[model samples]
Target chain A: MKRRDFLIGAAATGAFTAAPHIWRKDTSLARASNGEIKVGVLFSLTGTTGIIEESLNKATLLAIEEINDAGGINGMKIVPVVEDPASDPATFAVKARKLVVGDKCVSVFGSYTSASRKAVLPVFEKRDNLYWYPTLYEGRECSKNVIYTGAVPNQQQDEFIPWLVEKFGKKFYLIGSNYIYPKEENNYCKKLLEELGAEVVNEEYVPLGHSEFSSVINKIQSTQPNVIFSTVVGDSVVALHRQYRAAGLDPDKMPMASLTTSENEVAAMGGDAAAGHFTSAPYFMVHQSPENERFVEAYKSRWGGDKVTHFVSEPSYFQIYLFKQAVEQLAASDIDPTTIREAVKGQELIAPQGKVHLEAENLHTWLWPKIAMAKSDGQFEVLRDSKEWLKPEPYAAYPNQHCTADGLVQS
Target chain B: MEFFLQQIMTGLSIGSILLLIALGLAIIYGSMGVINMAHGEFVMLGAYGAWAMNAFFGVGLLPSLIVVFLGVGALGWLVERGVIRFLYRRTLDTILATWGLGVMLQQMIRLSAGGELRYVEMPSVLTGTVGILGVDVPGYRVFIFVFVAALFAVTWYLMFRTTFGTKLRAVVQDRSVASCFGIDADKVYSLTFAYGAGLAGLAGALVAPLKSVSPEMGTTYVVDAFFVVVLGGVQSLFGTVASALMLGELTGGLAYLWNDTIAKALVLLAIIVLIRFRPQGLFVSRIRS
Candidate 1:
């Protein structure tokens, strides 16, 4: 009788532990069958990258609210299950699993850094879920599970490097925050510089969030590079900019051109420090167009009057519209991730940047790249506009590698 | 010769900042033995205080320093009275509890301040570069070196020359005996914690114009501050100053020779080896129990 009691106790404990999972599965099924579609909003609301990721989160939510208010996808309300991974890549993977397998979200929109995206990649692939990634990245990846709405290395650096060499000088100093994104971007920049017979004076990477830049400033001054091409992100951007100015490095003589320093960073670094710097991106807050104006107005009104839009947030805002258009094309009962991805392949939207189209072959967006100089009031002054949208080459640095509809291909 | 001088200048600048950041932790952890893990949050609060003053009331960073210090010090007093006073005897619990408090403080700031990066404007007078020993250094950096020296002197006087410092040191040495001898040990501990937190606030306000002011900014400083305190001997204030400069020069020299990543790894490795040889740290306290 005692042995039987022990067995019963073990069985009860097992059932208790598994109860939450079973309940969650039942709710997921019921919600899917109901007149609502669920998607996960995974963005870091706190931690090191929270400064930028919070804006991205706000942008995603604004898009979702707009869609629902205008009547979401064939009269079906899109339910967003938001989660904060707190800027840790390991946490991102865990949250992705919960969103995919536990909450049963058909799609998720998230990630700011390349590290976070790489961490979550396997989860979506294994679970056959879609992830809408809207950050400009290192661009060597090709995944069917992700819809890439941001610019690739080629779209950003193809015209940016040559223009800098022609206007500034042949000598370039490359500095960035130590990470996959900056290293990869620098590699592409090196390849382009080699083709143009430009000299790389020095290349350096500091740990992320490193605020001390005196040594870096000393190096830049000693080397005297004509153009400092910086890919530093997060708090390091502000530190480097302020330190550079403090070291009396004139941006006019040898301006620091960057791919990552947006209006958000400028606002943090203070406009005076960023006044003469340049940045290359697909969008800027000052980009003049009716679509951009409306989007900016709507964003500020919804978020606050002080909130400003930038490159990453622009893509974050537009990708939801793209998702909505794709969802509109799908049948009411067949809104699975696979069908949604198929429907989204060739979708087009008049985004704040301009008219953008999702490439059917590679699943990356074609975007118009612009180079802008930061003004004293924390706004980008447009200097050069790529009149035509540039196609994304995910493997632009590798001559033989290409991203196709099937997968990454090499010849 | 110029390159070497430039590197030394960079090292001095780095060392000054490290000293400013680590001084507060040395006081809190050295005297109290509370293992206050929320020291970084105190620094964060100070930076936010400066930003708030500038953003809302048009007050500059210099004038806001005193306000931030007092405000953050009061917060420290509350924390001591509310959570830390009870856990004084339990060192491990204090660590855990303070860590949890740190997380709570970070989330609280994020919710209130909206997590976006905020900037502090540098004074116009300190904007230009100054030539020292034929090496051009920022005027602000030179100011930091002088300011930190003055601050350290003041802290040193407060800890050694004052009657309150005498009572605090007596309590730190023997809490029960000091309590029996008419020293209110609780008040000493509370005031000590508040003073340390106030120093951290001052450090944060001073560095606000140099770095980005955000919620997570404190985490970066706290790690380095802990390193300085550990390597310098937790009980020795002079040791903290010595170690900060040594680490600064070592990093600057090694980074100039190679790169930042290898330099950091080597510095950390050196610290580990040194700690293994001298577990009590570089400066051993002669205070008897």
Candidate 2:
């Protein structure tokens, strides 16, 4: 045999030998008998987003455990196949493809970024599989194959702009990490702010993962805007907050709000620095609801009482339940991909955040957003919340706005 | 015009950081002909050392800088004596080994710091702004620019005007010849590596207050340092400093007009064009084989 063929044969033999050894002996051969359904849980477990993803994964597992215990989704156990993407977008797509095509999962709930979700979009589209993305992203993309359970721009920025104008007046400073999400979000924010009579003092973009903010902080101080509107992501937010505090700028005096900062950031930034900051998201740990209380208690019980849960974690937790509901409703008769997709679009469930409805037209969810003021203990005190679930306007319908309703489609 | 000047100043401050990092790399590569891929890790170590000093000893910025410099210098010496000495003749092996070392060091840092960005407090005196000509500039950046320039002068004097410097140059010129003449080439090489690594650590400690302290922060500067070294000529210190400043200015000025991604792409394109014209770099001796 040629060298290549010999190498391939050797690799195949090695894999065959290793497979049995690595396989768990306790693996139950008792497969799903009648109405059981399997869903995939894909999250980053070992990379940059590991800490947050770990909490999300715990929440998801907790939800699954609770569902399974409570009659197992219409008397059939809801099985979750967990996969780690290792915080790589490409890996997310690969794992997503395998979950849908190989594992034959009814639905896949995954992704933490627009990039990661975008990576798996094509895979989901090609297979016409249902993907429930749990992270808030740039609003302008809607798709049939995906259910965006997170807040879109209109769900977030629409209320944010009017509220800021009413509370803080008309001057804003726009700062964000340089990426498609931040850039697009900031652009929409600026346009909205302008239309609402707010003047953007200055707009700045820094490289993602950039931590230095002395220069930018200096610029902000000089500009002295009414408020700072930020779209910065990840650990960069921690750096920005630290620098802002070090510069001696009081958040109360010249308040800054972010579209990105959530309970996760407050935990990372610690209570002292992140306190008094304003942030908008669809969920908060301190939401006063029976479902939310149960979620908080269960999450704390499973992932340690000291671990802080965030908006993203709650939504991710809800996605698994949503998937469970869809599978049970559809899987009783069939367990094919098409049925799962249809079931997901048609499913509506009471989540911890609130009652969320998946829009059949766009596959985006209608959920209410809460504006919270951060307390000293790294938790939010809900200052204001929408009384009703805001209908997801995925496509922009306004004539003056640059985007349209069709522009929001993801695929 | 004021905005343009302010951007230039900002670029210069940023370039000073690149210069400090590239200076260490150029010295090690010049003296030993080994590409110390772990140079960025040394810088990272220095930042951590400063953080540790603050955590343990309660040292402020000035004292912490000194502590990190000496601490990381000792670490560099230990690394050279314990690990780097064995792979002197094999350049590729040294590069690969140091790359592994870098990864190990970063992971160790991650295990300790937990992958979150932490802030190092800047000295009160260095906080605020200064008027430069007609424009307002950050006081910390102005301090950095002045400090790096003084550091460059001191390094230049030490390399060209001292006995140790003479021995270091002798080794770089001809190691076998210098050894035959009774010069302790190995000792010089080890000391040079330590000193170069120490400088890198100093740069890291100095910039920690200005940037976030995380395990992977060093990776960001390492790529830019490579470009600076390659563009400046590997063996020429002056060339590294000049090119680093020029590249920083170009990128910083353009960032004001365009997005940061496009600015970086433009810098990379300029470097590519430069390479096509001058393969030996702008300053290195073109010795034909």
Encode model 1's per-residue lDDT on A1-411: one tens digit a residue. Answer: 699999999998889787866544344444345778899999998777877888899999999999999988789888999999999999999999999988888899999988899999999999778999999998999999999999899999998999999999999999988888889999999999999999998999998778888777878888899999999888888888988888888989999999988888888888899998899999999999999999899999999999899999999999999999998897766778888899999899899999999999888999999999999998989999997999989999998998999998899
lDDT per residue (tens digit) for residues A147-254 in model 2? 788887778777777888788778898889988887777777877887888899888888788665655765676678888988888778887886676556788767
Q: Looking at model 1, what is the TM-score of chain A?
A: 0.92
Poorest 10 consecutive residues of model 2 chain A by lDDT?
Answer: A402-411
lDDT of 2 by residue, B207-273 (tens): 7776667788788777777888889987777888888899878776666565455677898999999
Q: What TM-score would candidate 2 get against the native?
A: 0.84
User: How much lDDT does candidate 1 score?
Assistant: 0.90
Count clashes in each candidate, considering only residues at least 3 apart in sequence or on different chains: 0, 7
